[model samples]
Target chain A: MKRNPWRDIRLHGTVLVLVVIAELIGTIKIPITQDVAITIMPLIYTIILGLAFYLIKPIKWIHRKQARIAEGAMMLFIGVLIAKLAVSSGQSIGLIFEMGPALILQELGHLATILVLPIALLLGFKKEAIGMTNSIGREPNVAVVVDKYGFNSPESRGVFAIFIIGTVIGTIFISFLVTFSLSFLPLHPYAFAMASGVGSASMNAAAIGPTLAAFPGLETQIEAFAGFSNLLSFCVGIYIVIFVALPLTEKIYNWLEPKIGRESIMPKKEDEEDA
Target chain B: MPDLIDGSENVSVHGIMNWIFLLAIFSIITVIGNYLGYHHPMESSIVGMAILSLITLAGVWLERYLPFNISSILYISVIGIILAFPGMPTSEFVLHYVSQIELLSIVTVFLAYVGIGMGKSWDEFKALGWRAVVITVLVIAATYYGAAIVAHIVLVLTGVPAA
Candidate 1:
């Protein structure tokens, strides 16, 4: 029956105000070529605002809590805006339907562990190292790993390591990759957008932003597909990691580790346990 | 004497007021966004906010009633689909104005919040050291290119136009 403090209106109101200013700043554009131009871009400024709140003493002291509070407040809008996009996407239902296979296939990208784990093993990474970098590092991935492997397992360190990397730089990395790939690839933007939503909000933003820049007309469909696909990723991602991705990685590791020779930078788990 | 106001759990003045406050802010910001970004009529932005606010509220209440929790995004998304159904009344208007909503600009707010959230974890990151960095880079590249390759193949096979 107790009220939640995070729901305080003053805190949410402050975030909304700051976000409006940031949005205005991000919306401003400058022409670069006959057809192309550059702009402030929202994600860039948002990160700056976040960094400022995080690093600056006064701002961190005064606004850090509000910034955190604002994060939750803004989540409400994400659904609303995505819904608005879905409404606009009705015209493209046929296209979305046709692209269903592509959307699901694209989501496989989030199962990074399946592909990366074997390679990490082949490259002389310790057996424990493979599990850490294999899956798309997100909130739930940690839970699944801890549950399956136990918190003290050598692999847990890998999960924690990648989890931090995923948290700190994942969004920016995904955004840049999306933008860069678009420059050369013949892939559809919707496919990329759906791929971006692989259960991480910032990564979704990074993926959607560049595609939005490239193909403005398809914005609604792209947003809708990405949003829906993200929801799917969130709902099913844990199971995928626990069952499909993890099992597949283990099989690959079992096959490759013997061939690669198990020399590794990390101390051997068996040796550590023995000591 | 009959009770002037019924004491029911469903009736919440505070909830209504909160939604109104949010709706007002959303409408004002949407107007500014339209001016700076989409250039839609001011009236459309206001109307769009009102409609969206209502949809959000409905989604919230719907979630409360559902046997299992459904995400608000999906709930509102279903509402959006029904509203935008072909030949439905106001479907055209909903289509026109929803397009004018600056979703990307709004997304910036979420990303900023995420950054702030990440910043709060500076110590944990510092402690993880460089191994995490290498792993992160590889994981990101692996996921992105892996997905991109699949997408590219699908697009090529479906003939949906390649980059």
Candidate 2:
């Protein structure tokens, strides 16, 4: 069915209500220690509330079709958020350029994904680990995996699993991660800001909100670094996944799977099942 | 919605119009959030929303019509940079109003939609099982920390003052 935004008034109205309620609650700080605190922003609350509304079965507030529409709308809304972040990036493009090497090199941090392969293999993930560990499994990354391995391939399943996990709790996890890192890590807030740009719009937004709250008065610079780095990830991320991440993942998987690979938890292949 | 990942789906004029309509609604919600959360004035927030919506629309249009294949985000960022670049004629005006709309407010609305949309995927999420969850968390942490650690090292090496 063609999406009719007008018909999805309930979804939009629900979002509006969530936004208002979330904002009203405002930023809350939970002190974990003398110097450490986890800052929960309105964005996190809004997501939790929205999720509650959708997941709670009794209410049946958001139908399946409506949920799908909301998902589509979320994708569209990202464009607007990107615009806002882009403007921030534009305002301080010069400063961003000044920090050029740091900004660009930080992206290599994406390679850290490979660090999880041994753990995944030990955990019994097999071929799936390639898809799951090669990238962060954002939409584009998922598409790349799907494109190469076919949608039903174990690799696609691996990527899809991470993609689903990302879609469901990525923002919350990232927000908390940023706050937690800020609390303990001795890194500069600017470096944290640059790291917040993990190539996913919602995750980037979630990551930056806490960073901005953690460090007052550097909002513009934080936004600029996060936005520009995210933009770089978005533009160049796919190619890296294809040329660098995938091939490297395959190589590592071949080398590591034999050494530490366990019986796969994933369902056996159809051929094996028939055999 | 269009196939944003592959760029195979052509963005129609009809689709753009729908985006504008949705963006207008998003702007109103964000303005309300900005005022209530950050105590920014509604008038300025509204103006900020308008400017952002315009920039987003222009970027979307360019993405659709431009001969080269490029993400709307890149176009939007370029347009935003051009408008807000130092000494640009419109820079001051653009910054003055748009700055009032807190990035968090926009994020709240965006994530709210994401949360609601997630209902359809809940079963899929559950079916992925505990191992996926564990791995996903580790992967996310690995990527974020890896990036932060790298950036921190470079910044220190380059003599950029820490914030």
Candidate 3:
């Protein structure tokens, strides 16, 4: 019942207006390779994947017993070792024959990226360097909200489910719209961040540069945006979702109170049907 | 290598199994991708994962399986690196799939994940926050530009065509 002031500011409102102002004013001269790789190509991938995989949940991934994880990992490792082996072999082979060092090195890099994630994560978190590991996938905001609601209601679950859908769709929708807009002007993620109020001014453009480079000539802008947009989105989006969702959570609490089998929060209303 | 079903204390048997299953589909897709080559890698990977997941889903619905499933997911991620290389002319192979895929969307996914991760690790982020986030974006953005800038400057300063 207490009002949260930040809710009224509308996080994006501040960031978006500044972004448009900046992009409209700034001028940039970009290097061609960076321009293409960072902006055009990456942006193209982002937009395309957004449309295709946006609705498809990323979390529900392949899960199986005795899956080929080790085999797959080993394959990746072997692929890397082969590349290193090829390096030595290809060197003598190339010097003796007339080929290139590119192949072996390329093979190694590819294998490395694929195989490195697990090892990297394991190493990265060797001693709880990252966080209070307990917080990995949990949401503190949601927990607090649940505690405040203090009722077990099926309707609450229903609303929360819808909220999940909303969050996902909203994320996707914003991505789609931003990409569409990106197609037109020489825009970047910085513009999106500033304009959308997602995170920082230039971050979005920077990050987007590589992804959208496929579009040609738009790489610079796209890469810049990636740098800032996501952070802004995270901050603003969370603030917005919490501010909006929690207040209505009471209704959610009431609706779900009856449907759920558990009784914990609110006292049950005892009424005589005969009366 | 840890077993697909089991892992060390740092990892878990349960978690390993889950990731292993993902790796299985990822491996299938990877094989398909290799066969398809750089061009159709994304498409092939997506299709392979989808088919595997769908079959798995059907099994679950039929009561022959369990539902704590990574019940549905698909992605075609690895091909980009293969497609992008110096001296290798932009072959029709590269051109074909590159045109179809949307790289920006993927970046957004990552950015969103980073955002979520930052939120999850608020303490870490708060300490570094704007400075770290900005620096990361700069480095990444500059990577695109830095490579070119360094190359260009090297050539200009040396009065040689770096190319």
Candidate 4:
């Protein structure tokens, strides 16, 4: 299909429209505790954009390659905001140190995903399913899995499955989970803010949204912490997956393959061959 | 140096024009959003948008020139931070105005694009079958609680009271 340039313009321009609408809703105060009411803006604009994207179905014009470029460019400005937050954060060096244990713990939590491998194995998932569920289902995981296991490997299938899921629902899940935890947990909001970063920008934003809304005063510190944590995860996460996460899953798979007695856990021929 | 200039000369006018157009639209959205949301004066909002545009442009170009696979977002973020750091000459204006820039709007738009991208890949996602659903659940469980557990322990150790 020949792409329409005007539609391309609107597609890219949608963000601008949503920004205006979000400005109109402004912010709302939520009572989290006595003497502390966190004011969070209702995400009306996001909900509206989501509804329009699905119902209106404006999924034409911009080619995939072009969209990727546009997304990358949009993210660049977001990054600038993050950097600004970081600079603001640096002024309060005490908060940085005060938040250290929380940051490290969260990174460890991100790394703790290795636990999923054994669970998958014990659940009778084929050897191939181990790699996919064990690491984050992001782009880099896709690359690493394809590189080591080959594109057609059972491992690749597992990775692809999780990647789709993560792409579609991961941010929403993270956002909700963090918000729910905040109401019940006794931790400082800063801890949740750092934990919110978790590598993916969208996921970071989603998780941080409630936290920022809850403590609008700390937006800069929270954004900066999340950005920093995300950078750390991105920089170190790939290596962890390649050297530790993937390899460890492989070892666990080998050990559990015997216990399952080579039962055909794979449902399809392609998965069997890949295995 | 001569080779670099030759390469720069080969840059297409269409690409640069597209970039400029995108930047203009972004600036317009930002200025209007700032004026409406924060109730800032229109003049200040325009000034703020101009500064943001320049910084963003520099960031886009820097990403192209810089080596390695670092994200453009990180590059732009560093540039914004350095230029607007607390004692810098432009710190006051940049900090005061940039802070007014609405983040959730960009986030919402970004996610919407992501959704569209996912919709494009719908067929591929469907092909993964049921196991994909199971894997997704497990991955979410591990990640969400994994981070939460760590935070819980650390906070408790630090003597922070639970809510």
Candidate 5:
């Protein structure tokens, strides 16, 4: 059956309703300590509520097809968000140029993903460690893995697992992490804003939302820094993943697999059997 | 691999039409959200969203027609920067209206779609078991903090005061 585009009306309508409700509720701050509070934004609420409505079996409000449509629409909608942020970058181009080194160098922090490999190997992840720890395993990263190794390869499976996990909870996780870090970290808000551009649009937005709320007076600068940093990440990220991250991951996997690697919990692949 | 990797789509007439349709829906919802959440005037919000959508479409056009392979977002960002850069003819007007639409308001609408889309993947999410979940948390923390620490150091080195 040919998919009718109008069927998406249901998904769009639901999101429209959810947005209105979320905006009305506004930002909520829950006190976690004397000096720290977790700031929950309207975006966070809509995501949770939209997920609940979709998952509720009784109503069948969203079909699998509609959900899939929503996913495609999401890719396009992110462009609008990028355009919005890019304009900020343009308006504040002078400030961005002044902070150019910080903006450029902070992306190296993505290399910190390797910090998790030894743990993954110790937990007996095998070749899967390369895919999971090489990067945050967003769509492009997954594609690189799948292209190098076939889709059925262990590395592909590793990348897919991270991609799925990222799609599901990455925004929430990043937001909370940003909020928590803001509470105690002695960093400047601009630094935090630059760090918040983690390559993924939704995740970047999630990270920036909290940082903006925490430092209300610095909104323009924060937006400009985060937006430019994110754009930089998006443009340069794939090359880094393929050249630097993937090769580095393989080397780490080789060196550490013998030192602390445990027996594999996953079944052995055919390639491994021959070896 | 696929279009997702190269960032190129079919760009057929039907595809372009669908994009326009979806963008219209997004703009309407965003205008409503901007009004309710940030109290931006609805008229300005509408104009703001229209400008954004036009920029997005132009970026898409460039992505499809440009000889080099590049993501649409890159084009969109460059176009936005040029249009809004200081002393540009469009800078004042573009910034005036676009700024009216709050970043968080656009985010709220975008993530709602993300959330609804996520429902289909719940079973796959659950099947990943505890180990993947653990690694996901650890990796996120490591990347975020690692980058923040590096940026903080750079900023401090450059004579920017810490908060």
Candidate 6:
């Protein structure tokens, strides 16, 4: 999802309609279980965008095409292998057999999974990686307003790093604060909300996956709650990010521009090696 | 995968009937199982993944025929769905998972055409152009500590011992 850069008119329009339909389902409160059926449109959007090119266009035996099919299979393999190993190792250590080697082995699978998730993600999103990634750092096109803002300026890049680090620190600080407050106040259980809140749902869940398994108790419950809550919140968060967050961010940028100075927002010249 | 695509060998494996057949079977079984209330037979995504993988292995090992691909689709789709929607319980995510799998599958095909424009910074966030990072951080912090303190505050107010 991160790498997609294409803005195909048909694809975008189709996905947009599907998302609208999905949102409408949520609004209607369908008994088909909004949680499950709500996924229909997003999935449909994704599949249509994906399979549409091949199914409708020149590629008839699309699935048989080596180039694309290979990548799909490769990704499927990586995701499955990581998930499979992580689960089997964890199960055997916790449920079936109790041995240090077995336990370590299982833990390794979990660790590897956490470490490689982002990379796997990058690979899977091969189509949009460029556009999406650029959309993040700089204006995708000159026509956009963020254009006047220097994407190549030093301050812009440096400030970006500082803010990201700050967010990470903030996420942890927030989690710790919650723990502290729990000792003194009555609070609603976060469930899976907090973990996803820390970052993306997949990320927090993967990172804490091992901890939750190894320590199964109230601690685990809290993580599960955080994971679950985060997952739900993530869906809402993405929309807010696109609509509310991005616009609000621009407003804040404009407000700060006079005081912060134009130079304050300039992104620094990055090394070619890094690129 | 770049190699696979760029490779000169053109030995093609037509999976049209295979794809249709497998998709049919997966939809049938998932729908029937879901309707029958075998919802979430596996407790966790991890466990469910393992179970499905095992079934996939069985199908793959059983024959070189179409069932392997069908099983593969179902297994991968299940994992993809869980990864995409972390909040969804396995029982509640049957159809949801299948759709994500197909979506991810399609996107994965074009991954090679893309590249990352990495920017150098003192940290991971360096080169990211945004002031709203502050709001992002602040909101996250507020939510985290806010929940924690309130939970504790309630306990103290109620005079319930902290477990």
Candidate 4 per-residue lDDT over residues B69-123, each given as its tens digit: 5544445546665666667787777767655654443344444444433333334
**CA error at residue A10 for candidate 6, angstroms:** 28
Which ranges of candidate 5 are over 4 A from the true structure?
A1-3, A100-104, A117-275, B1-14, B148-163
Q: DockQ for each of the predicted structures, in order?
A: 0.23, 0.37, 0.07, 0.21, 0.37, 0.05
Ranking by lDDT: 2, 5, 1, 4, 6, 3
**Candidate 2 residues A39-71, lDDT tens each?**
566777886788789889887657655565665
Q: Candidate 3 regions off by >4 Å? A: A1-275, B1-17, B23-45, B48-118, B133-149, B157-163
For model 6 the interface RMSD, in Å, equals: 18.3
lDDT of each: 0.59, 0.76, 0.27, 0.57, 0.76, 0.30
Candidate 2, CAPRI quality class derived from DockQ: acceptable
Candidate 2 stretches greater than 4 Å from native? A1-3, A99-104, A117-275, B1-14, B144-163
First chain TM-score for all predictions: 0.60, 0.65, 0.26, 0.59, 0.64, 0.31
Candidate achieving higher lDDT, 1 or 4: 1
Chain B alone, model 4: TM-score? 0.61
Tens-digit per-residue lDDT, A1-275, candidate 1: 42332444554444455566675665445544323334445546655566566667865342434444443344444445556555655544545465568776666766754656655665556655655765876645654564356434556556756765675677666666777777987666767766767666666665777777788778888788778766556544554665578777777777777877446655433322210
> Model 1 Cα displacement at B25 (Å)?
3.0
On residues B1-163, what C-alpha lDDT tens digit does candidate 3 reach at each position? Answer: 2243232222221233444353343334233323322233555445433332333333223332344532111011112222223233532344343333222222222222222212221232233223222222222222223222332343345453211
Model 3's CAPRI class is: incorrect
- Alpha-carbon DockQ of candidate 3: 0.07
Worst 10 residues of 1 chain B by lDDT: B1-10
- Report how far off residue B59 is in candidate 2 (Å): 2.5
lDDT of 6 by residue, A154-195 (tens): 323332332233423432443344444434544433322233
Q: Which is the winner by lDDT between candidate 3 and candidate 5?
A: 5
lDDT by residue for model 5 over A22-116, one digit each (tens)? Answer: 99999776654433344566877887887788899885667655665665676677678778867877886675566668887887888999989
What's each prediction's TM-score?
A: 0.55, 0.67, 0.25, 0.53, 0.68, 0.31
Q: Which stretches of candidate 1 lie over 4 Å from their true place?
A: A1-17, A20-24, A27-40, A60-68, A98-275, B1-16, B37-40, B112-122, B125-136, B151-163
